[model samples]
Target: MFAVIKTGGKQYKVAKDDVIVIEKLEGEAGEAVSFDSVLMVGEGAETKAGVPFVEGASVAAEVVEQTRGDKILIFKKKRRKNHRRTNGHRQDLTVVKITDILTDGKKAAAKAKKAAPKKEAADGDAEAAPKEAKAEKPKAAKKAPAKKAAAKKATAKKAPAKKAAAKKKED
Candidate 1:
C-alpha cells in the first residue's frame, strides 16, 4: 500500500520500507516519528483521499540520519550599476525510512520514553545556598568620553548661531 504524506510544506508518496529525505525534524537516528497529515492512501485500484487531511490516518517512519541538501548559488546584479551579490545556501534535511502505514485509528510501534536527567549536588554547595542569602554584585556604570561630550556641547552651542545667521540671510 502507498500513502501520500504531508511534511515540511511538501507532499510525498511513500510506501512501507521506502526511504525519503524531508525537512529537519527533531529526532535522532534510529528514532521513530509519525506523520499524521496523510492526504491519500491506495492499494491497487482502491484509493482513499482526505478532506484536507485524513482523520485517524498516519505514516510511521524511522530516522535514518540528519543531512544537508545540495548547495544552490544565488547571483544578483544590476546592469550599468556596480552592484552585484553572490551567495550560496544548503537546506537542512532528515532522512527517514517508512515503516508502517496505519489507517482507521491503528497505531504504529510503541514509542520509547526518554528518561529525565537526575540532578546531583556538589560538595557543600547545596547546604550553602539554603543557609545564606547571596548578595548581588553592583554592575559597573559605563562612562562616556569627555572629548565627545565636549564636542557635542560645542555643536549644540553653534547650532543656535547657525540658525540665527540663516535667519539674517533670509531677511
Candidate 2:
C-alpha cells in the first residue's frame, strides 16, 4: 500500500519501509513521527483521495537523523551599477523511514529501542588481545612526533635570524 502525504509545504508518495529526506522536523534519531495530512491512499486499482486531506488516514515514520540539505549559492549582479551579492544557504532537513500506513483514525505504534550487540561470554580471552594490541600503537605514534618537534625547532631558529636581518636593513 502507498499513500500521498503533504508536509513541509510539499507532497510525497510513500510506502512502507521507504526512506525519504524531508524538511527539518523536530525530534531526535529513532523518534516516531506521524503525518495526518494524507492526500490520498491506494492499494492496486482502488484508491482514496480527499478534498484537502483524507479523513482518518495517517502515515507513520521513524526519524533516521536530523541533518542539513546541500548548499545553494545565490549570486546577484546589476550591470553598470557596481552592486553584487554572493550568498549561500543550506536548508535544515530530516531523514525518515516510513513504518506504517493507517486509516480509520488509527494511532502509530511505539518505536522499539535498539540494543548493543552481545559478545560471547565464553571468549573472554578474545577481548583482552585487542586491548593489548591497542596499547602498543600509541607508543609508536608518540615517538614520530618527537622528530617533527626537533625539525620545527631548527626552523624556528632560522625564522628569528631572518627577522633580525630584515630589521638591520630597515635601520
What is the C-alpha local distance difference test score of candidate 2?
Answer: 0.90
Per residue, candidate 1 scores C-alpha lDDT tens digits across 105-162 of: 8999865533212123434377765554342222222234666788899888754444
Q: Report the lDDT tens digits of candidate 2 across residue range 1-171.
A: 999999999999999999999999998788789999999999999999999999999999999998998899999999999999999999999999999999999999887643212234326568786887899999999999999999999888764444433434553
Off by over 4 Å in 2: 113-171
* Candidate whose TM-score is highest: 2
How close is each model in CA RMSD to the real structure? 11.4, 7.1
Residue 90 Cα positional deviation in candidate 1, in Å, after optimal superposition: 0.9
lDDT (CA) per prediction: 0.85, 0.90
